[model samples]
Target: MTLRRLPDLTWEDVGALDLDRTVAILPVGATEAHGPHLPLDTDVTIAAAMAEAGGRRLSAHGLEAVLLDALQYTPAAFAASFPGTISIGGATLAALLTDLAASVQRAGIPTLAIANAHFDPTHLRALHTAVSAINAGGVLRAVFPDVTRRPWGGRLTAEFRSGACHAGQYEGSIVLARSPERVRGEVMRELDDNPVSLSAAIAEGAQDFVAAGGPQAYFGSPAAATAEEGHATIETLGDILSEAVIDALGTETWPRTKEQT
Candidate 1:
């Protein structure tokens, strides 16, 4: 079955679906500064690509996949100083996620899977809080494969694992693969590698991009990004999301065990 975009389907179309075997994939991202070379929506692009890929994979596994519109506004305190960065309250984001899951549950969808690329601490915390609330509700299952954590973190490219990957080769490559036109080719080629790890900075009590040693709102190697690497990394991200969803479902059986009586 082809992966469906939720917005494109009418109420009748959605009502006709066997929601028991369906998964709604939400692409979570942030509208924040990446670098001089990349667009502010870079995270959104990557998240959408991951969701698309993951949705296809879920379809292959016999579950109907529905792609929800991207979640673009989130807490981005780390990059708040940047000109185009838009930051929201962590509590607000958490509440939104919780409510979203409740609505999905009421619509009869069994699972909501997140395809996230933004890694701001505030944003991560919000996601954690919302997922906890969603699961506690006991109706909707929220599947979040947090790439910043262990196991999932280990599966990405070296640049991603380095913790200095904000708008660096890791993210730049994915943007290059998914939306090359959004990249500033001239500036990207001249950028020097900023290997200071943002993760390490946060651990050491640093706040915001400048304090993390990324004065230009960037980190790691940007000049080294390639579409090939981006594609590969997206595939890895997709696999991570798909596997998480499957695991959360508690079985490989996508087919419903019994008819809905």
Candidate 2:
């Protein structure tokens, strides 16, 4: 069966689905500079890829899931100094998520899974608040956050943990794997020596990294990235997210009871 995409799904199409077995997957990503090798929309691109992969996997099992257009360009305060880094601030991001959740709920989707690739603390917090509010009001039946923490997250590991987690070998490899035509090999070579250690920088909260502080805006060694690793990461994430969707949908309940006032 062909899976439905959010942008292409019509009201009639939505009405035909088994509501209990369907999930709405929202791909949330950031538009920031990913060094020299990857595109500015690396986070958004990866999130979309993950969502699509997960949706396909779920669809094969008689469970339906659709990938929503990624909410690209999140609040990246730490990387704001870098060129091509576009942010909307914490308040705006929170409001956007809330509105999106509200719309999904109003459309009768019982479960909403936010597949986010960007690991900004503020964005995560905003997502949590938005999802919590929607679920608490009984508008959304359930919400799943940080789908990456699942077992499938392990597949992203490589010689460089920074690459797998941020704009490094992992992301560059995935981009090359999924969309090789877009990878800029020349730029990757030019910025090969300016890789940043995301964990250390964030832990220290210091603005003294070579990428963010110096010439480049990347945090990992894209030189180590390969198309093979990217494919494996995508496949693993797909499996994890598919299972998550099934579990989430199964746990969904209806007829919310009113609290005693």
Runs off by more than 4 Å, candidate 2: 145-152, 159-165, 193-196, 207-215, 251-261
lDDT of 2: 0.70
Q: lDDT tens digits, residues 97-209, model 1?
A: 99898888988998999999999999999999999999998888999999999889999999888898999999999999998998998999999999999999999999899
Model 1, C-alpha of 206: deviation from truth (Å)? 0.8
Q: State each model's CA lDDT, in order.
A: 0.92, 0.70
Score candidate 1 by lDDT: 0.92
Q: What are the C-alpha RMSDs, in order, of all predicted structures?
A: 3.5, 6.4
**Best-performing candidate as measured by TM-score:** 1
Per-model TM-score versus the true fold: 0.96, 0.85
Clashing pairs in 1: none
